[model samples]
Target: MVDPMKQFWVTVAAVFVALLIFVALPVVFLTGAMVSAVTSPSASGPSGPVVIELDLRGGVTDQAPQNPFAMFSGSGLSVMGIVDVLDRAQDDDDVRALFVRLPEAGMSPAAADEIRQAISRFRRAGKPVIAHSQGMMQSGAVVSSYMVGAAADEFWLQGNAALQAAGLQTEEIFFARAFERYGVEPQFEQRYEFKNAVNPFLQSDYTAAHREATLGWMNSVYLSAVANAARDRDMDRTVLQQALEAGPAMGEAARERGLVDRLGQVEEAEQRALTRAGEGAETISFASYAARPDTRRHRGPVIAVIEAEGPIVTGTGGSASPFGDASTIYSDRTAEAIYDAIEDEDVKAIVFRVSSPGGSDVASEQILAAVRAAVAAGKPVVVSMGAYAASGGYWISSEASHIVAQPTTLTGSIGVFGGKFVLSEALARFGVDIRSLSVGGETANLFSPADEFSAADRAAFSGWMDQIYDGFIQRVSRGRELPIERVREIARGRVWTGTEALRLGLVDELGGFHEAVQRAKVLAEIDEDADVQLRRFPAQQGFWEQLGLAFGGGAEAARALITLGALANDPDVQAAVREVQTARARAEGSHVLADEPL
Candidate 1:
């Protein structure tokens, strides 16, 4: 029989202790873990001979988050990181060789070219580089993985792996017929015939001009691939082209056909690499090697590498979701980064890396304005085109002091198109109605989905498109220093491969990031052989700030944070989210180029 008051106080204390153990303790543990990861020290240099192991299965991006916690967050490797590692290895005496594990799916052609160029440079430093592939499939243009492997001194494929070098192809889906069945109509117009971005919503099949433009770029990319593979394997171009047409070769057939150097498993490839690296050599993860601190110090002018990737949009670029899922180029964010570089006295020049199919006209203009401002500041601006840089992508790129692109880079779609879909009939089919009232302007209802464009609307819209298209051509003519007539000849919304673009005076050179960097160095009046530090933008946030953004405060933020966190951890969910975002973007009138294969 205990006293009542004492018993009540004891029970309250027990409940409080239980809450701390069950709830607060776990949160504290996680927060501490995050802190520890962020504050961890960088790895030191290797003491013995090392063969750097690069696993490309995770794919590569132009810029990866610099947050140390990014490793725990499952972010993939970056192209610049890999290039930096290779560059470091070239000068590191303890770095004996390089061993790469190629992925089943192919990378983007431009990305592969950049990595391949780095590998070529590594080999030129007298270090042997070997590539191992379990299987290579015809995913996303198919020639990418092989192109990267061709740069290696030795290439090995597993006995069960098949070589699917099926070449490049693209498909377009039309929804005009579907829209008709659903009682919806798409009203759109473009500046010219070659601007086929709107064709998916206007026609059921490819128009003549659309077919010509598509085939022109496709043929250029295909021939480049065939020629590259042939040159790498020391085989006849015609024979290699014929073999690719008859591909899907497996095991010994791949080696016999000169597609691979040897037939073996990954272990065998590792043994070969180890043998070449000599006794006492160990295989080290490339990530860990890259993280090692550089004891050597150099005081040199900084060359900033600012990346503009994904669909361009207004405002600061970030996933709206609470979890830091993916990134895109935002006009304000990019312009701010450019302004930062321009203001930095240490930054001598800038290399703007663009990987986009293009988006909003206003957003593109905003970024173009930043480029112009950078030039006016007396800092040299060089554009490095990656993957699909066309239309709005070219819009922002035109004013650069120089432009560099991979031979297979799809670019040069200088065009504009816009319109609204009338969905009133579709809603009526579902017994729903939309009513609108407007005041003050004749074309005030231009974006209203309930009404189709009137004759006046069409005329006014056409005039607007003509103005944008003319402005686009003038910019290109002025930037590229081509005659207005010559620019017009290639301007009509036509797409060109980097090779063709170089010939048409659209791009300054056909090369990868290394070449672009060399050009930047020369433009800055720095010696090509001089060592310069590369500063990236936008600047990385601190640990606590990143955590705050990742795990939001308040009840609503918590719910979204939890949901997004779950989605980010699930690959299937992430993929679904991407598909949904792409569909939504298209529905929202994002103008992506037709040549983007992904």
Candidate 2:
């Protein structure tokens, strides 16, 4: 009964309204949010006698995520962010004290060290830092948790809780025997005996060199942890070390042994902290405090902090999930960030924060090139190594103006190893067969899974590995000002704790991010006590840009979905995927990999 013209008009009106609601309005809102976030001065903190509550239940991140939403969420806990907050609060009279809850599971040793340094500085400013632990489990990073707790003015343990702040242990599973039984062969060549990254496939047990190298670093880390705790607790270093080695102790026993200062529940600890904070002092969660603007403002020389955390790879780096923390140090992205810092006139110095195991050789070279370029431009680049900076991690850091690492940080695996597993026989057992044909040189099918490496292939691959290894040692020698012979003496792919690395001239200083920043300031001729503006490299993206990437259509959307799914899988499965990817790289002729297997 309706007229056709009237119907057409109504349909057009509905379409236009839908567009306004779904597309046009969202675009406008995102644009507004981006502008506001970018331009607005940070909101000031509440005025009061404030006691900051730092909860370390979740592990700390190396750096804040690039996600624009994270800017508003205030969910990310990064080492530098926490340090900056604590440093700022040190001078704020309104901020009376810090009450910390140690993480249930262990965090990275380097991160714990950085936070501990901040707490120490805060206490030096005459503010109390109270730390409480519910329990220290025998698993995970209990040692790291205790390290942070030991820095506190008043360290407390829950009643009936066990103190498992004992030591560190790493478990390795060798697949050589299992592979043989399953009719699979792992053929690999390492640069030297100490380069044991591929040992799981090559030996059923640790070789003499492998065991020696592993124990050397592990013992150093353990000794350093004990010494640090002893100094903080005012106890004899030998006695503290002996007590921890005796075994786990109960709460009261821990207090008696001078391991912890008191035994109480978390609530009691919090109340005690508040009482010490002063009359009518209110508590503010660390995250909330971090979200608030810094009370003191300083316009000073700029220091760029460029963070690269995770595996180094070719091409671009991006968040594994738009809303998650996992990311990679893609060569192009990291190089661009370094270049950006170099180009910024206000950036007087560069602090390169690296936390990675290792990845592509080419990618590491790219990042290292950028570091060299920064020095060439007269900007000093000081590296602050996080938990582990081995293999490719060391590659990029080798040529820095200065390098700082926590005493427990693992570094200096200057060696190469690569090969592939011949899986034809294993596949036959499963009633599966893979066939392939190629027309080319003798080496055309060198990487075929159906065959193992021949003599010619092995020789060629070994020579390639030698080239990479030689290049790595040469870079280290030049940077460290050591003789090539000295470099070679220590270049057998052995991992060293930062404490030992300092003695060996592998790392310039044994400290954390705080020390690195201080060194950067010194190198740049800035006053020791002067405040510096820390400009983060690869600046966070705007809200509109992130929104577009999150919901964009086509191949990009599909790739994002796939990455999200993979990241959301079980941790074990993700680990398996990582191992498989490494093997695949080796099979694809990437025979010059510098990696460590901690």
lDDT of 2 by residue, 1-598 (tens): 8566764555455334333433332232233332222333321334689899998886678776665456445446888788889988898888999999997666777787888889999999999999999888766456778888999999999989888867877768999889999999998878788888999888899999999998888787667777788899998999987777778889888888888999999999999988999998888877657656554534799999899888899986343455655657889989999999999999999999998888888899999999999999999999999888999999999999999998888899988888888999999999998776778776677778888787877878778889999999999998889999998998889888888899999999988888899999999999999988888887764444454354332234334434433332335543454466557658898863532211
Worst 10 residues of 2 by lDDT: 34-43
lDDT of model 2, residue 355: 89
Q: Each prediction's Cα lDDT score?
A: 0.79, 0.80
Report the CA-based lDDT of candidate 2 relative to the real structure.
Answer: 0.80
RMSD of each: 12.5, 13.6
In candidate 1, which residue pairs clash?
none
Tell me each candidate's TM-score: 0.83, 0.83
Candidate 2 residue runs with Cα over 4 Å from true position: 1-46, 67-75, 295-298, 318-324, 542-544, 550-598
